[model samples]
Target: MTFSLATWNINSVRLREALVLKLLDQECPDVLCLQECKSPVDKMPLEAFAAAGYNHVVARGQKGYNGVAILSKIPMQEAGSHDFASLGHARHIAGKLENGATIHNFYVPAGGDVADRKVNEKFGQKLDYLTEMRDWFRDNRPEKSILVGDLNIAPREDDVWDHKKLLKVVSHTPIEVAHFAETQAAGGWVDVTRQDIPDGRLYSWWSYRAKDWDGADKGRRLDHIWASSDISQSAHSSRVLRSVRGWEKPSDHAPVFASFDL
Candidate 1:
């Protein structure tokens, strides 16, 4: 079966609940993976989603902090969850389908302001998180898998609007890029978005601090969908819903989507 899967960092699930419904009504992705939900499992407004025909749900959540969830129209089984860097953050969750394809939804920490880990604990933790992820994947390689989330680091120069201008920026710093690349390599994953839209300044996130976000358009492609090499060849119709970024009370990050036939 062919189905569309999408990932978005909704910022605060509670705040964007309405917008989420709107997107579901419009896009109708079979599976929607969400990051930065910022609500506990019980606190998540799942009833509305169920009403919208998205009954299958699984998530790892913490109150007022990082969270991730997968809402699907098709039934799913809980695959697993992980604590990257042992940070005790609700950042990773997985789901498995009847077809045996596993989906890992992640919310990698957004390392603090400074790039130097010595001066920034969050930055250090972020690097450690990536390291652990690489080691984990290297040891227990995944197959027929689709990974999606606000990975928080824009690894490619073309991923940012102005790479030179954002060289020292938190998300685009060399260290973050290198670490993310290493993890991807170890995981044997292919960047589905870039695989389809190979040569362009593609972005999924724009800072809310920008007075005129569209006018500035200084955005980064921090959100992504990666597939294991085995299933990467099956990925088709990849896209980023940039229009959702302009929606009413929208999340800073837009939804990244891809359709697959396995």
Candidate 2:
């Protein structure tokens, strides 16, 4: 079977339900994983999404805060989820498709403006979260799985608009990148997006603070799609919908896409 999937940090799925619907209408990927849903599962617009032809969903959410979800046109079952750092935040969700492939959707903490954990509790929490994630993958190696989310870190130098300038920034710091690498190694995950587009200034997020976001073109590849080596070669057609950032009242992030021929 061949299916397409997309990952997006909708920021607040409730607030951007229309945008989600718009995306479903424009480029109907077979599965779409969303992060930062910012609403309780009961409050999510599942009815609306179902009406858009995505009938299956697995999600974990909270009121006005962190959340993650996976909506699919194909049959799926809720696999499970983890609290990672035990932060009790709704940051992860998983689903198993009929093809026996699992999908993990996550919304890792942004780590805050300060990279130092000394005075930054959120930064410390972010680090702890990743450490737990690495351990989980190390203990239970994944196969025939695809993981997608707003991981909130840019691991590659080309992932940022200006890597040197952003080295000290929260998302591109050396410590965070190292944690990211270790986690990737633990899972034996192949970056689907990077595998397709090996080089260039590829990015999926731009700050809302930019006065002329497109013109300035300052952005980061904070969102990702990763597949375990067993199914990595089945993945292709990866791309980021950069134009979505220009949508009316859009999220700072753009949707990233990939197709699997498993």
Judged by TM-score, which candidate is best? 2
| 2-112: candidate 1 lDDT, tens digit per residue | 889999999999989999999999999999999999999999999999999999999999999899999999889999998989999999999998788999999999999
List the candidates' TM-scores in order: 0.99, 0.99
Candidate 1 stretches with Cα past 4 Å from truth are none
| Pairs of residues clashing in candidate 2 | none
Model 2, 1-262: lDDT tens digits are 9999999999999999999999999999999999999999999999999999999999999999999999999999999999999899999999999999999999999999999999999999999999999999999999999999999999999999999999999999999999999999999999999999999989999999998999999999999999999999999999999999999999999999999998
lDDT of 1 at 173: 92
